[model samples]
Target: MEFSPRTAIVTGSDSGIGRATAVALAEAGMDVGITWHSDRAGAEHTAEQVRAAGRKAAIRQLDTTVIPGCAAVIDELAEELGGLDVFVNNAGAGDGVGFLELDHTIWARTMDINLNGAFACIQAAARRMVAAGNGGRIIAVTSVHETQPKVHAAAYVSAKHGLGGLIKTIALELAPHGITANSVAPGAISTPMSGQDGDDPEPTLYPGIPLGRSGRATEIAAVIAFLALPASSYVTGASWAADGGMLQMGPVGSAHLDSSNWRQG
Candidate 1:
């Protein structure tokens, strides 16, 4: 677990789970590279937190949907931080369009960010690690939807399922190079993406979350940090769900009721 002076990159780190992960990595004694798609201020704030933790912080602008160029940001940050030791593919977009209403444009956008972007970035990082002759960690921030499906999020579900498969493949390919690949699948986390401005969850969101509340971004980050550790070398090709027992509920929960209400709003 001695990550002292190691370098890590976290995408979509301007806020939410990404921000928490960047800071957590810093606190664990690793220099962190933080990227934001649109929120420069939030990225800066995350940098400040990293600096305060006595670790170096590098910030960059990355739009995962930008194709091959988007993945180059990892190289840039690695150069700035001296080298790459960990890469967290946390940048993703969610879709809520029903299956019948989904369009090619929406599906493409979702796949471009959540799947294509991650593939490119992982390739870039793994190349560096392999060339450097040092093992590295590759963690993707998938969701419970990676396994369980939602009523109206066809695109997102498909992209995450693909991501899960990609991570497993990477785990097999990279293990020979001494690198490890895994995923952290979160449930309802109280981030801006989940419609909460703060760490606390709304009462209405409690019904589906088995812990009776939404999770905090830091909760998910802690798991990511564990997977990043050198001691986790044997844990590749696994999806660690940080969900509040929601995934375990499965068909037994109230969510299984024969109701089309989930598709209405």
Candidate 2:
């Protein structure tokens, strides 16, 4: 437990990375609010895990795209937890469509959830924190695509890219208020959504990946927990990469050379 008596709202926290983040915060001794759009059972399960960590938990329905009274939702959660301290903007979705095949609707929907939703959620959380006159942490979960361009994911890539910029801006704006904002961009993580058999997410993510493996949700969560820690009070407006040396290398080249094929193992 790193931050006790603190309240954190992790949106879309029913499963996968979001669920893991919520649990991580709970284990850090913070009371957590679990928001789910469609996974009530999963949300309750997460709450149970939080409670098991000896902290209070709250579950709420937060469709960030709607942006209807989202701050009110956070206010309620903060009241329940006794105060607001940290907020994780982990809710998002992607279209998985390439630039050419991507429809306007797909782009709009992707932006609405991935980019716009995060913006709204951050604003709502910040408003409550400022109102309560308490400094807090706001961590956004971006993707490797935030900087790397991925094929067949134009909308997703663009939205993720914008998310990083948004976090930077928020960090600058909120610094005067003693609130910190940062982003965590994770590489291919072994999640059910990535369909990696709960083992290796990307044995072949790309030859450029020096680590030669996809990351895990827990791995990413650990970095997030670092930013959320009170010790990181001096850190803000930074984008931390958890891509396993992917960024240290060159681009993901598609051209495989035949001369590279060796007969010997």
Local distance difference test values of all predictions, in order: 0.88, 0.81
lDDT of 2 by residue, 1-265 (tens): 2333377888888887887888899898889988888879888988988898998899888776676666767777777877778999888887777687778888888998888877877888898877877688999999888998877788899999999999999899988788899999988677756775332244435555778777788788888888888888889999999988877665343344356432221
Full-model lDDT, candidate 1: 0.88
Model 1 weakest lDDT span, ten residues long: 196-205
Model 2 lDDT-worst window of ten: 256-265
Q: Write the per-residue lDDT of candidate 1 for residues 1-265, one digit (tens) a residue.
A: 2332388999999888999999899988899999999989989999999999999999999887888797688899999999999999999989888899999999999999899988998899999988987788999999999999998899999999999999999999988888899999999888888776743344345766678877889989999999998768679999999989989887777656678675563
TM-score of each: 0.94, 0.88
Model 2 lDDT, full chain set: 0.81
Clashes of 2: 1
Candidate 2 wrongly placed segments (more than 4 Å): 1-5, 196-208, 251-265
